[model samples]
Target chain A: AQSVTQLDSQVPVFEEAPVELRCNYSSSVSVYLFWYVQYPNQGLQLLLKYLSGSTLVESINGFEAEFNKSQTSFHLRKPSVHISDTAEYFCAASSGGYNKLIFGAGTRLAVHP
Target chain B: EPEVTQTPSHQVTQMGQEVILRCVPISNHLYFYWYRQILGQKVEFLVSFYNNEISEKSEIFDDQFSVERPDGSNFTLKIRSTKLEDSAMYFCASSDGQGMSIQYFGAGTRLSVL
Candidate 1:
């Protein structure tokens, strides 16, 4: 069985400050990781993913997540935050190309102006 | 870019009634799935369908749930009896079935059981 754990349930950050959302997973085999963002009343959108290659993956919107095999962690970070960035973030895992995706409880990001 | 779509953006039903949620995955995708998110909880997998059959399902998908691909393009999820706990946002998603391919999601149908 595979599972995802997000360290924080809520994070409040000031606009222009850097933010990091922590995630960890438990799996017996190799896994693919992903970060998804959901805005108010909108469906979730892929923020970034880690399938293979470089450990660091980045999204177009200044968000990035690094996959750490030893730590069993894939943490999402943004260099600077904006009020508009307030949303819910989910971390998910799919081990061995089986894409059933086990998701974390999600972190509620509240970017304050 | 092609995207997954779902119908009946919101549905209100009484307890013990049956409810069907419909989805139309991307035209070329091979894997379709249904997931749900209860208020203030993480999204949970319900079932996954491939080749017109269920490939995987979660414990939450018990006797009350069934999925069908009655047509080439339409995938439907039926619940035999609606419960208040079943009230949630049901999301329909699809993937290309390629190794590590990311799943695209629909806007989701808000199911409200009275």
Candidate 2:
């Protein structure tokens, strides 16, 4: 079975500061990784994905994540964040050609102004 | 950009009552999926539909759950005899069914069972 684990349940950071949300996964075969963000009362939106390419993938919103195969980790990072960046972030994985994704419990990023 | 749309932003109902959640996937997409997230829980896959039929379903999707693409654009999930545990935010998503295609999600419907 495949599973995703997000290390932090809550991460608080000041505005304009950097932030990182840790995620790890356990899968026997090759996998596709994704990071999604959910704003208050909104559906999840894809932030970035790693299917097959460079280990580091970036989103238009200045967020990036690196897929580390050796450590089985895909951690999300941002050089600087704004108050508008506060949201719940989820790490997900899919394997075996099935589109169904197994998601992590999620990390709540709270940007304090 | 195209996006998935769902109806009834929120629904409240009794435990034994049946509920049908509706979704209109992106017009050109060929795959549809349903997922739910209970409060404080991770989002979970319920079912995936293709070619007007179910191609895959999770253990959480049982006999009480059914999906239909009754028309050219509308997809629906019907839950017969809802349970208290059914309370959650249900999301509808769509994809092009291509390899590594990303699924676009709808705003989701919050179901409150009493």
Candidate 3:
């Protein structure tokens, strides 16, 4: 069984401030990590994913996440946030062989201008 | 940039009523899935369909739940008898040939069982 844990339920940050949303996972087999963002009343949009290769992955919108194998963590970060960045972020994981994604309770990022 | 589409963005039904949520996945995608998110809860996978058959289902997908791909373009999830607890947002997603591919999601159907 695989499970994901997102440490913060809500995060408030000022515009241009750095922020991090922490996620951790546990799985018996190799896993793939993903970050999805949901705007109000909208569907989830894939932000970035860490399948293999580099330990770090980045999204087009300035969000990045690093996959730490030893720490069992995949924490999303943004060097600077904008008001438009406010949204619900979900951390998810799946075992390599299947498409089933185990999602963590979402973290709501509230960016203030 | 094709995307998944779901119908009846909001549904309100009395308890014990049957509800069918519909989805039209990306045209070329082969894998389909259904997931739900209760208010203030994490999203949970309900079932996955591939090759006109169910590939995997979570514990929450009991006998009361069923899925079908009645036509080449449409996929549907049926809840035989919904209870108040069944009120949630149902999301439909689809992905191309799978190993680590990202799944595209629909806007979701909000089912409200009263």
Local distance difference test, per candidate? 0.93, 0.94, 0.94
Q: Which ten-residue region of model 2 chain A has the weakest summed lDDT? A: A94-103
lDDT of 2 by residue, B44-94 (tens): 999999987899999999999999999999999999999999999999999
Q: Candidate 3's error at B8, in angstroms?
A: 1.2
**Candidate 3 total steric clashes:** 0
lDDT (Cα, 0-100) at B3 in candidate 2: 84
Of candidate 1 chain A, the 10-residue stretch with the lowest lDDT total is: A93-102
- 1 against 2, candidate with superior TM-score: 1
lDDT (10s digit) by residue, model 1, range A1-113? 89999999999999999999999999998899999889998887888999999999999989999999999999999999999999999999987343698899999999998
What's the true lDDT of residue A4 in model 1? 99
lDDT tens digits by residue: candidate 3, B10-101 = 99999999999999999999999999999889999999999999999999999999999999999999999999999999999998856677
In model 3, residue pairs whose N, Cα or C atoms come closer than 3 Å (at least 3 residues apart or on different chains), thus clashing, are: none
Alpha-carbon runs more than 4 Å astray in model 3: none
> Could you give candidate 3's per-residue lDDT for residues A1-113 as a string of tens digits?
89999999999999999999999999889999999999998889999999999999999999999999999999999999999999999999988544788999999999998
Q: Which residues of candidate 2, in runs, are more than 4 Å off?
A: A96-98
- At residue B8, what lDDT does model 3 achieve? 91
